[model samples]
Target: MRRPGSVRTLLSCLSATSLSVGLMALGGGAALAAPDTPPAAAKPMPAQVVAPYFETWTGQSPAELAAASGNKYLTLAFLQTAVPGSCTAYWDGETGRPISKDTFGRDIAQMQARGGNAVPSFGGWSADTTGTELADSCTDVDAIAAVFKSLVTTYGITRIDLDIEGDSIDNAAGIDRRNKAIAKVERWAERTGHSVQFSYTLPTSTTGLQANGLAVLRNAVDNGARVDVVNLMTFDYYDGAPHDMAADTATAAAGLHDQLAALYPKKSSTRLWNMIGVIEMPGIDDYGPEETFTTEDAVTVGKWAAAKGINTLSFWALQRDNGGCVGTGGSDSCSGIAQDTWYFSHTFEALTAPHHPHH
Candidate 1:
């Protein structure tokens, strides 16, 4: 389920329990004493990266989706974070107290069997177990970093995403803690010779990333973290309708480009663009009919992202990539708009060149 409003709006309503550990910290970046060091070059991706959001706990299993699509989609992002009290990542609503590798091992194996990859996402709207919350609960930052490393190594995935939002995004203390822990995680990867990539999934307004959103990026560099990509949830703009969904998303992405230019002054303009991404909620959004992201909108955004050489292109979910629930209000089961199954996915996939690798 989506939040009642944009993350910024929800920040004010959190209580002490939640505030003790939050995720969104919109404060201006604290000036660091050390001169900024050029961030390590993000690991090279295929000619074009087209990874779609795969809701592992939703409509169908990763293998099922991949089979049905005839392996047209090779990379899928599994939705979610692990349990809150422990470092283990598990599917939301499962009864297991301490989740283990078996929790999702079968599904992971199934996807990999079909030549597909899973990007483990931390934190989403439907769960209380956020990435920051998971990190805050840990006594040792290394332990938290270990959890991330273990998961990455276990799953054979080269990339991971931190979707910080809602109460999780508002917690300044939690934000710092999470950044530090992730920095350590990157360090571990470097020292162990484990190649890994990191991306942050954040909310945004039409103009660009909100104050706290910007802080999340700055803090990464300030804490000596390597962020491969800054992904924007380019949907639900303040929970209202926008004049043009595609244009609004592109404008916000452009705004982010300028912000990154300042954050990494030495990086070339093209490299900065490659360090950015856009994640959209196709079709009718939870906000209501006022905002409709049509298949055409996907094409528009795809073309712009491709032309701009953006690092990644994905959407809110693959479960809703069908037209079964058109105009049925917001639904996790479908995009709530009329469209053939896999149409939206195919549209976005077209953004990449034909030679780009796909399983």
Candidate 2:
């Protein structure tokens, strides 16, 4: 399932727009825990984190998989409205998983109890296209901001990831509403002494973010929102050319570095790199053989990510880290390549060292 919410391909999931400057550069550093201190629920998202996307629809406990995968941080995939017209968002758009404490609340608390956390993400290919994306479905800016606030208060989590792809990227009104809500939430966080950060997870071509993704950031800047991390889906280029998945990630990230340099001109090159995040699909993506990310590639990217001092290193999912379905192009449960389970997780988790990020 080469997809977001399962991305079959990124080509159809994207479009372009112009770009801006902003504040809130995400550093790759976190406060060291006191030797005798208890694990805090309000742990700040590390300056550099290895948070792979965790698919929520699979009925697996996120904390359980995270523990199994050796991932201290997992970006929970998609909280969107159950219907196209609703302002309320539910996990996987399921009513049973509404924005309530009963929904994955304990799971998140459990993760935090130890020293881990989940980055709750919004919008995926399904939500972006079906008009279920929050900003696209709900025009009320206050309501959108309320939902974001709820996550902070309910989960005590620090970062929110917006996986904007498909028509959502091309959507001007939705883009503006989303960013405006982001600004609103950031302002509230600042006033309340809450530590919250927002990350944009958008699709990318081989070189970098195309126009549509840039437009979203431009809107965020125009609306006075702070974008902490710009996570790129470095897979699924879909340009009908052979891909060196690892090399493409480097090129794409370098391209994003340049784009980010312009959008955040006031920041230093190091800060701009620190603001970057690269998400690989792990094994074969929706585009088949041409875009396969071999195990060796994962090794390359992981070490490269650490050396570059990037903000985050992640894959399409935690579940898809095994070699259960070899030769397959896309499968939600396996990497489709020969590799040990949790290989990607173990490889990239090194970037989260207490001493790394150099900031």
Candidate 3:
């Protein structure tokens, strides 16, 4: 509910270590999509991959995000359409117009000028048609592509994240339409000499992506879309256990490593790991202590991912990284757990410090 695959048969078809060479031997199975003809230019990732979600909460802004972590990447959350099918207008009031800039537009420009860039994340639990919902309302894939193209062109963003969750993740038709629309965008990028990377942000089980989530990723590749990253929202399992948060995270990421290796047969183990992202929800979750994610856990997971070369590391809203809570329950502004200001943020940010460039 928050910020939020495949298997043995394929292993017999090819080896995980030398998957790149095995694609031709296997005639390009489900794992391969016969690299696009003439080969399209590779879509690019963010200027800096590690970006925390910045959204509705007190004490959180683009400037706050830039100032807090000192990192170059920040994900400006929830850029959706004003209406389900109204592609020309965005939910943030920055309609495809000139002169007047909405809060998001102004702040993003400011953040960019500070040597930091942002990824316009489409979707969240809030109102507005998420990326999938917007695509579902339109049958014209080109139109859908145009909406995203305008966003990337206007904002100068190199990547966009599709945070698919709730009803949107299971909408099979929407998933297919969304994938087709993304494929069109990739093609458009190829023609325009712009590098754009598309990332899917979804929920995960301890073992990795659940069935619907797996389907979402498969839909992307089956429809001829290249997924640059698969970011897992690794909290709120809601199983009601006092689980070892960091251990679960490492296990979940390992499972995803295997799945990515299976999905992209030609990718090396290290490269596949580099395409994985983990989004942590700092402090006590809505489920309380049964699902707590402490700062110590953040450090553990950060070091684990850094050592393994994980693509990006982020968390839920940065507003919750403080200690304004009066009790141990979920709050939008501050972490329910007892902690100092910016404890989680600083710990996780340290994982991406200069000495740890591999992260």
lDDT of 2 by residue, 1-359 (tens): 12233254322122100001121222222332342232257778877889998877766788788888888899987788878778998877776667655667777877887698889999888788889889999989999999998888777789999988877888899999999999999999878767789999988887889888888898999999999999999987767799999999999999999999998889999999999999899888877888899888987887888888899998887878999999887777788899998888888886776654533
Best by TM-score: 2
For candidate 1, write residues 252-282 as lDDT tens digits: 8999999999999999998999998888777
| RMSD of each predicted structure | 9.7, 8.5, 13.1
Every candidate's lDDT: 0.64, 0.81, 0.65
How does residue 264 of candidate 3 score in lDDT? 84
- The lDDT of model 3 is 0.65
Model 1 alpha-carbon drift over 4 Å, by segment: 1-4, 7-47, 70-85, 93-101, 113-115, 128-132, 355-359
The positional error of residue 128 in candidate 1, measured at the CA in angstroms, is: 5.5
In candidate 1, where is summed lDDT lowest over 10 consecutive residues?
A: 8-17
**Candidate number achieving the greatest lDDT relative to the actual structure:** 2
25-51 per-residue lDDT for model 3 (tens digits): 112111211322221212255323678
Task: Go through the candidates in order and give the clash count of each.
Answer: 9, 14, 0
